[model samples]
Target: MSGISIVGVGNMARALAARALAGGNAVEIIGRDRVKAEELAGTLDGVTVGTAGAAPAGDIVILAAPYAGAAEVVREYGDALRGRIIVDITNPVAPDLQGLVVPDDSSGAQEIAGLAPEGAHVVKAFNTVFSHVLAAGPAEGRPLDVFVAGDDAQAKARVSAFVAGMGLRPWDIGGLAMARALENVALVELGLMNHSVKHTDFSLGITLLH
Candidate 1:
């Protein structure tokens, strides 16, 4: 499995690191707060904390932050991130955090794609899954489905492998434009979360009725 570079030190970033390491990938985390980054790294063995400006160059960089944070990190690391697979986990929800903040035809992933290097490929995944749900992979290690939307076929393939390493199956939803639907799906999922009685996360899975 290819190693992963995570660009934040929050819950989502930690979750990605845990899942990636558990999936047999080398993980490096970078962010603004060195102390917090180091703390999170200590929680997970085999994970290391590196400088934000000097984060490891990897096959994939998971932007595990909000859309605002994503933009900031991409802008700062625009040059270093060239030719790498960038996974945009940002969902631009309103202040209420219940609905999307983007207008029709544009999305968080699309916005991040704009700031990226010409050849840098960006995709959307893991936005819909609750952090806790992903923290614990499905029992028996069956792959959960991660719907991916991106423009570059090669980048998508790399991300697909990374997703699989985390014990999840990656489903291609077509070009980067497809991320709009993916984000909306997350909003719908959030609505469902509010009604849940407990911390048990409800995940979406496609099943054939036949």
Candidate 2:
């Protein structure tokens, strides 16, 4: 399994790091606050910690920050992320959860991709899963489906493999352009949570008639 570096110290970051470590992948947690990063690492056995500005030790770097801060995080890393697979897991939605905040033609992942250093491939994923559900593992005896969108086939494959390693399913929806739809998918999930679902334990999934 490929190693992963998660650049945040929040709930999503901790959930992902725990799953990656459970899958036997090398996991590194990075944050602007080294102490918080170290604290998160301490909770997970065998995980390493690094400061935000340092070059990540993993081949795949997950920008676990929110949509507002993701670009700045990437800019801070700069060329250090060159040739790495940058995973964007942000859903740029309005504060009231009424609509998306990004422009109609450009998604948050697209915006992040634009800021990524040359040679770095940006892949959109995990935006549809809630942090608590992810931390709790699969839902209703089924592995959660992680929707992936990226122009780079190899990068998507790597992410898919990592998802499978964590006992989940990865659905390669299409190129990065489809990231907009994925973001909307998250919005739909949130809408459901606020209305019908009334909870955060569920995740978006697909069922194929075989």
Q: Kindly list the per-residue Cα lDDT of model 2 for residues 56-123, writing each as its tens digit.
A: 99999998989988889988889999999999999899999978888899899999999898999999
Clashes of each: 0, 0
Off by over 4 Å in 1: 139-142, 195-200
What are the lDDT scores of the predictions, listed in order? 0.84, 0.92
Each prediction's TM-score against the native?
0.92, 0.97
lDDT string for model 1 (98-161, tens) is 7678778889999899999877899998887878778877745455778998988888888988
How far in Å is the alpha carbon of 85 misplaced in model 1?
A: 0.7
Candidate 1 lDDT trough over 10 residues, lowest sum = 193-202
Which prediction has the highest TM-score against the true structure?
2
Cα deviation at 60, candidate 2, in Å, is 0.2
Top candidate when judged by lDDT against the true structure = 2
